[model samples]
Target chain A: MIWKYICGSASSPLSVSFSERPRDGQVIFNSGVYLIGVKSGLLALSARCPHLGCQLAYNAADRRFQCPCHGSQFSLKGHRLKGPAKKEMTVLELRQDHECEGYKVIF
Target chain B: MQQTADYGQQTTDNNHGQRTTDNGPRTNYGQLALWAFHVALLTGVILSFHYRPWGDVFKSVSKISGWLPYGDFLRKLHYLAGQCFLILSFAHVLEHFLKETYRRIRPKEWSRLVLLFSLGFPLLFTGFILKGDKEGILAGEVMYHLAQEIPLIGSGLARMLLRPGEEFFLLPYLYHTVILPLTVIFLLDRHTRRLLPRGDWGWPFMAFLALLATFFPLPPDIPPYMEISHISGPWFFHGVQLLLRQVPPLWAGVIWPVIPLLLTALLPFAPPKLSKWGKRLTMAAWLIHGMILVAAWL
Candidate 1:
């Protein structure tokens, strides 16, 4: 099954709002590119490295989001690879658009 | 501080694993620092009694003539005490780092130590700028701009912040010298008690009171006032500020708050294993920080 969101207002693809609770990964909308780790069946978490608070990017080659500051790594599903942070990566929400032309976020 | 601790119940009799050997040397270092602090406090108080924050007589300690009893000694003591206070506070930090006092204390205690440091420096800032001399004026300028750097509420606060409106200096100097400093002292006493529950710091503290009785001593008086040419809030603060000065304003002011959070998370999982090497690194950092402090002072 494919997920589709139909938002009302006219907005750019990146402008759509996507947010999820900590339990489910949180989707943070931003101007910069973020490597979000999404499990279609389960969760979505913003791709930023919580350490040093750097915006995280997906390293497709490595299949993980790497933090620029101090280099902490997180798995695609938001599981933390190491310490320094007592907790795991935050989870957010996401839905797969089976076939939406543009990434317009809907409520 | 006492109230916060005693309520939890202190049990010195826990003999299961206690080290009560009075080797005396370990305690002596702490005691020496305490002695210095007492002397400084003494000087600061007496000098404050004769000192006028701002007035025409500032050109010379003249109007303060044959006036209030022991005025001269009070003034001298103030300057000397300030120097002593600065030295002890710094030495205390270094000694703690060496002995790893930070390791055994409860996190709550470390947090209190941080808070005391943050508050203590501000008191020193107030004391300096209120003097209204060259250093005071220069210090005030730095403070005014720094306040502006605060987020949402900074603009209004910084603009109206005290200075003599005459453009040459700020007015109502009482805010820095008397009002703010007193508030800091009150808070600091409560804080100190919490860290050293059974320890009594009074006698040594009183010695600082005595030192405040000595001379018409003024600081080096280097650099012009109101120019903001050099930034000297208090020596302890100056070191931090100087380190930041090496970087751009955006980096120092904006990026700094974020750095700690990132470092905390990234450091543990850092490539370096949490072994003897990690401990060594932390110690190295301590030494490096001290060296930097000395470098800045020089």
Candidate 2:
């Protein structure tokens, strides 16, 4: 019971526009979320690292998200590149909103 | 007959009623560590008066450094004294390992000393978290998730140590100021048969720290959003920090730290061969950890 309370995510769904997305290979942080513009598409990732939840910092030069605490690295597409983290970065569900020309990110 | 109590020399009555010299426990790093603990406790108490745990803890700490009279000096002194206490305590344990003092001491007392040594981690770490700086906050978060990596009870334990979705400093402040110090004091008295060190071994250490505080004020706290590529935890955590890069958190955070404590616990009761193996493993672990620490720094 208490575990559920402690582990539960606090963020709600966020709607971000296509224009607001970062350029290719770049990442923009908006309200605890990382919106990365990868070569394929926009990837919305939770800023918290899966390993120890230390905030991940995007290295534009290296084009990888690095965990400052434990050195877990993820690709621009949110794939696990190097780890202590056994899992890839948590990608929120993105639904296209034709009306707003944007996507609804379910955190 | 009259005798002098000096170093390891002590006079004891032989079976024939003649006085004979016996080697007692000598003054060692343990005593010096205790003295450092005393200084740390004193300065911690004084510094607590100026520290505000509620609302904008970073700014509150900044005020202690920038606004209050001699607050910066006192804070630095407290930080240095705490570090010395931890380092000297480890050195004392190392000296014991080298001397095989555990063999001579009663198993119960040795076990108590082991517990005392283990307590140093939380005592020091909670204080580090209470600083409310970027490194400290991230370190606390790391600890939380590390604790959460345990199988069944992880979440409960993590929540107990650090309240999730809550202001960070309150619980850590309580642990740092009250619970840990009292536990340390009790264990120190039980293990050493005295709470305070004899003579003034601590004064020189304190003097050195005072001089250091005068010259080297702690670096200003940086905000979390800064483009700092690497955030290091406390110096003692470097090895684990590096290890976490290579292994899973369950191994790096939980199992690795517990291995030494388990070995220390088993040493007194294990068979001679097992004890020898335990000692060897402990030494190897420290060596690897030292190398890893160096690697993390580089």
Candidate 3:
């Protein structure tokens, strides 16, 4: 469970609130795996836009994912907002590990 | 532009400075359509001897062009003749519009002609898809996806239109070879009989088509595994393809094409007072279509 290491414990003061400004807190483990700290909680999203398999870029100013190829937009929760993409971005399941210092992602 | 008492009977000046009894100006479009149809049929028959409908269709097409003697020539002739038929039919329709032949005498004929003309695009597309090459495969994929996206009955329609798996190749082959050709020929015969009563435009046009076929032969199909990024449909569909990139699949793939066709079919029934505006609108629609096609090419 990778989420355990990514998402800090509930007692940890390091859990930063999500902001609309550019931050260094976002972590991309691989091409499609992305981990970001949002106001709701730690959100993990598959960066691939469902429209045409183009990689999505996170826009800090808008706090949304935007596809460079077809301009498909998605919210922080992986819900599709606009553009030609028919489906939402895939949201990966994440869980907290009590023994670890961070969170664990359920594959 | 002089008229006689009998609508069927008229006199026209010939190329040799002699007055000939015929129906209006003999633009020979009907004759050209007849000849092109014949040439297409002949070449299709010849190509059918070698073209297999099922598995490895691309290979069979290649074999026809590569191994069989004069097979390549026949294939090219068939391809060219089909293209010629499309062009000739379009020209015939345009001539009717320009001459206003359909308005004064038979208004319904224009709608029928438009229907027939509309059928030509699908015929051409199905022919291209039958090749089963890289481009053909891509075209099939586009068609399948587009069909699948059509709201409720999409999946069922796609399954019916393009069977399951490799058998999909057979559907377009049937359409290109049998169904569409027969329908076009039937409509063409009726159209020619009504418009050009003097239908016997003899063997000279056939000879001309033969000469043209001999001079220009089509190239062979490319291999299926080629590295190509931009897969496009037939030229007539280029405009729609352009639209597909900009809009949603349903709108671009279905609605855009259907709109023009519906307008063309309904144009003849428009009130006489709106005839001028109707013609302008139709022309503008075609102009927009042409522009989209040009943009796609660019």
Q: lDDT of all the models against the reference?
A: 0.46, 0.74, 0.66
lDDT of 3 by residue, B24-99 (tens): 3356665566576677787787888888988788899888888989887777667776776778777776765665
Candidate 3, residues A57-95, lDDT tens digits: the string is 777678678865446788877889987888998877866
Say which prediction, candidate 1 or candidate 2, comes out ahead on DockQ: 2
After superposition, which runs of candidate 3 have C-alpha atoms over 4 Å from their true positions?
A1-107, B1-25, B194-208, B215-220
Candidate 3, residue B9: Cα displacement in angstroms equals: 8.4
DockQ of 2: 0.61
Model 2 misplaced stretches (Cα beyond 4 Å): A1-26, A37-43, A93-105, B1-25, B217-220
Instruction: Report lDDT (Cα) of residue B23, candidate 3.
Output: 34
Single out the weakest 10-residue window by summed lDDT for candidate 2 chain B: B1-10
Per-model TM-score versus the true fold: 0.48, 0.83, 0.67
Model 2 lDDT at residue B298:
85
**lDDT tens string, model 1, B101-144?**
44444434434444434444555566666555555554565556
Question: Which one wins on TM-score?
Answer: 2
Model 1: how far residue A71 lies from native, Å: 37
lDDT of 2 by residue, B1-298 (tens): 3322222334453232333233344655677778778878998898889888777788888888889899889888888877877887777677667666566555665677778778888888888888888787888899888989899999999887887454577878888999899999988766655676765556776688789989985856776556567888888888888888888789988998777776775567767768778788877877877787898788
Give the residue spans of candidate 1 off by over 4 A: A1-107, B1-25, B28-72, B151-153, B156-217, B222-246, B250-289
